[model samples]
Target: MNFFLETLRFIGLCLYYTLEYIFLLFIPVRKKNVAGEIVLITGSGSGIGRLMALKFARLGATLVLWDINGEGNKETARLARKIGAIRVHNYACDCSKRQEIYRVADQVKKEVGDVSILINNAGIVTGNRFLEAPDLLIEKTVEVNTMSNFWTVKAFLPAMLAANHGHLVTIASMAGLVGSNGLADYCASKFGAVGFAESLMLEMAVQGKTGVKTTIVCPYFINTGMFDGCKTKWPSLLPVLEPEYVAERIVSGVLRNDIYILMPRSLYFLYALKSIFSTKAFIPAAEYLGLFTVMDTFRGHTKKAEDKHQKTGTKTPRSLN
Candidate 1:
C-alpha cells in the first residue's frame, strides 16, 4: 500500500510538471520578426531543412541554402525565391568539411550580409549495427552530425557576438535523449549535439550574453525521406512527427527565443523516468512493454532500404512499411 501510494504521488508530480511545461510552451510570447533578417540553414536541400527554409522565406527573410547536393541546393533556392524570400543564395559544400564551411561562411558574409539566424540541421545516419559499421562510417557520422555544428557556430557566432544579437538553432533528435539499438553511431553524434548545445547555452548565460539566444530542437521520427522505412510501435506515446509540424514549431521557438524545444513535450517525462529508474529495471521493463522494439524495427527496415538502394541505383520514396 505504501509503495502504491508513493508511485501514485510520483506520477502525480510528473503530470503536474508536464502540464506546466505544455502551458508554458503554448503561452504567447513576444516574437522577433524575420522580415529582412538573414538566415543560414544547412541541409536546406530537402526534408526538415527545406521546410524550415520555406517557413523563413514566407516570413520575408533572406535565405542562404547550404548542402552537398548542388542540384538540391539550387532547387531549395528556387523554392525559397518562389515562396517570397527577399533573396536566396545557394552554396554546394560538404558541411562535414571544416574548410568548406569556412569558405562558405566567408562567401555568405561578403555576398549576403551578417546572418541573424543559423540553423544547424544537417545530419546523417549509418543505419548499420555497431559491429557492422565501418570506422569511416562512424567518423563521417560524428563529423557531419556533431563536428559540423562546431564549425558552423565558430564560423558565424563571432559576428553574432559582436553584433550582440542572433539565434542559433540546433536540430537534434529524440534518440539523443534515449539509447536505442542499431543506432550507436547516430545516437552518439546526436548526444554530442545535445551536450554541445547545452554547454553553449550555459556559457552564454555565464557570460551574460542573454541577447544571443540558442534553441535546441529534439524531436521524434520525422516523416522525411531521411528516415524512410522507420517504424514506431507506440503511436500514442511516440507518434511519428510530420516535417511541416516540426518546422513550424522550430520557427516558432526561434522567434520566441526558446532555449530548449522538445516536440510532443511528453518525451521529457520519459527521459526523466529513464534517468530515475535503474537500467536493469527499466531496460527489461521497456523491452517487455514493447518500447525497445519500436526503434529496432525502424533500424532494420532502414538498413534494408539502404541496402536495396545501393544494390540498385534507384532511390525509394519514404514509406512506413
Candidate 2:
C-alpha cells in the first residue's frame, strides 16, 4: 500500500511538472540578478569560456578567470575590463593538475572572496578513434574534462552549502548524452560531467540547500574553434552554434535556474528517443541523422594551431582547456 501511494504521488508530481513546463513556455521566466556577485569561470582564455566571462562581466559581476595560458587569460581579462568589468582577476592555472586547481582556488578565495557563481568550463578533446589515441592524451582528456570539475566543486561547494546560495554551471556537450565516433574519451568525460551536475543538484535539494542552483549545458558542435573543423550532418537540424549565441544562452539559463540547456531544442526529442528505444533501434535513427559521420573531418583546435605554426614557422602554444 505504501509503494502504491508513492507511485501515485510520483505520477501526480510528474504531471504537475509537465504542465508547469508547458505553461512556462508562454510566460517569461524572471532572471535573477548577478550584479556585484563574484563569478569564477575556468578555461576563460578562449572560445565559449572567454565569451561567458564577457557576458557575466557586462552584467556587473566580479569576474575571476582561469586558464593555463597566461597570455590568453590576460587578454581575456583585458577584454572583460573593457566591457565594463571593474573587478576582473585572471589566473594562469593548469586545470589538469589537482594541486594547481586547489592552489589557485585558495588564491581566489583570499583575493576575490567566495565565488557566487562557479562555471566549470575547462575541457579538452582528443578527437581520435579510441585505439588510435595516445595514452597520455586520453589521460589528459579525463583529467581536464572530468577531474577538474570534481576538484573545483570541492573547492567552492563548501561556501555555497554554508550560505545556501550559489550556482554551479557545467558546460557539457551533446556527445555526452549520445556517443559518436572518434570521441570515446571526450564522451566519457562529458557523460561524467552530466552525471556529476545532476547528482550535485539532487544532493543540494535533498540537503535543503535549494538556494544553491545547478545547471548542466549540453550543446551540439559549437563554432568556437575548439571543435574547429567538425561538421554537422544536417545544418537545419543540428546547426553549429556560434560562441556569442551559446554564451548568451548560457547566461539566460543561469539566470532562470534552468536545469539543462540543450541547444536547437530538437535534441530534447532525440534524447527521449534514446531513452525510450533500444540500442539497435536508436542506431538507425542516429545514422539517418548523420551522427555517425559528423566527426569524419574532425581537425581540432590543436591540429589547426599546429598546421598554422607549420605554415608561419612559429611554435604554437597549447591551451590547458
Candidate 3:
C-alpha cells in the first residue's frame, strides 16, 4: 500500500513539473537579483570569463576573477571596476593545478566571502587532428577543463549546500553534446563538464537543496580569438557566435536558473535528433552539418596571435585565458 501511494505521488509530481516546464517556455523566467552576491569566475583573463565579469560587475555583484596570467587577470579586474563593480578581486591561479585552485579558492573565501555564483568557464582546445596533437597539450586540456571543475566545486559547493542557496555554472561547448572531428580532447573535457554538472544537479536534488541551482551552458564556436582560424561550414545554421552575445546569454541563463542552456536554440533539436536517431541516420546529419571537417583550417588562439606578432614584429598576449 505504501509503495503504491509513493508511486502515485511520484507520477503526480512528474506531471506537475512537466506542465511547469511548458508554462515557463511561454512566460519569461523571473530574473533573480545578484546584487551584493559574491561571484567567482575562472579563466577570467579573457574571452567569455572576462566578458561575464564585466556583466556581473555592472549588475552589482562582487567579482572574484582568477586566471593563470597575473597581468591579464589584473587587466580584467581594472575593466570590471571601471564597469562599476564595487568589489572586484583578482587572483593569479593556474586552473590546471589542483593545489593552486584550492589555495586561491581559500584566499577568495577569506578575502571576499562565500561565492554565491561559481562559473567554471576555463577551457582549452588543441584544434588539431587527434594524432597530430601534442601529448602534453592533451593532458593539460583535461587537467584544466575537467579536473578544475572538480576542485572548484569542492572548494565552493559546501558553502552553497550549507546555505541551500547558490548557483553553479559550467561553460561547456556544443562539442560536449555532439562529437566532432579534430576536437577529441576538447570534446572529452566538455563532455566531462556536462556530466559533472548534471550529476551535481542530481546530488543537490537528492540532498533536498532545491535552492542551490545548476546551469550548464553549451555554446558553439564564438568570435573570441580562442577559435581564431576555425570556420562554420553552415554559416546560417551554426554561425560563429559573438563573444558579447554569448556572455550576455550566460548571465541571463544564470539569472533564470536554467538547467541546460544550449545556444543557437536549434542545437536543442539537433541534440534531440541525436538521441532519437540511429547511428546511420545521425552520421548523415553530422556530415551534412560539416562537423567532420570543421577544424580543417584550425590555427588556434596562441598560434594565430604568434603569426600576427611575427608578421608585425610586435609582441602581444597569446594565452587562451
Q: Pick the candidate with the highest TM-score.
A: 2
Q: Using alpha carbons, what is the TM-score of model 1? A: 0.86
lDDT tens readout by residue for model 3, 1-321: 699999999999999999999999899988999999999999999988999999999999999999997898999999987777779999999999999899989998888899999999998888878898778788889998989999999999999999999999999999889889889999999999999999999999999999999999999999888887788888888889999999999999899998998988888988898988888887789789998788888787878777888898887543332
RMSD (CA, angstroms), candidate 3: 2.7
Candidate 1 weakest ten by summed lDDT: 312-321
Tens-digit lDDT track for model 1 on 150-243?
Answer: 9999998888888888889999998777777778899899999999999998888898888789999999888886766668667787788899
Could you give candidate 2's per-residue lDDT for residues 1-321 as a string of tens digits? Answer: 699999999999999999999999999988999999899999999999999999999899999999988998999999998877799999999999999999999999999999989999998998888998888888998898888999999999999999999999999999879888788999999999899989999998889999999999999988887887888888898889988899999999999999999997888988988888887887798788887877788888889988888898877544333
Q: Extract clashing residue pairs from model 2.
A: none
Q: Show where candidate 1 strays beyond 4 Å.
A: 1-27, 285-291, 295-321
Better of 1 and 3 by TM-score: 3
Q: What TM-score would candidate 2 get against the native?
A: 0.96
Give the clashing residue pairs of candidate 3, or none: none
For each candidate in turn, the TM-score is: 0.86, 0.96, 0.92
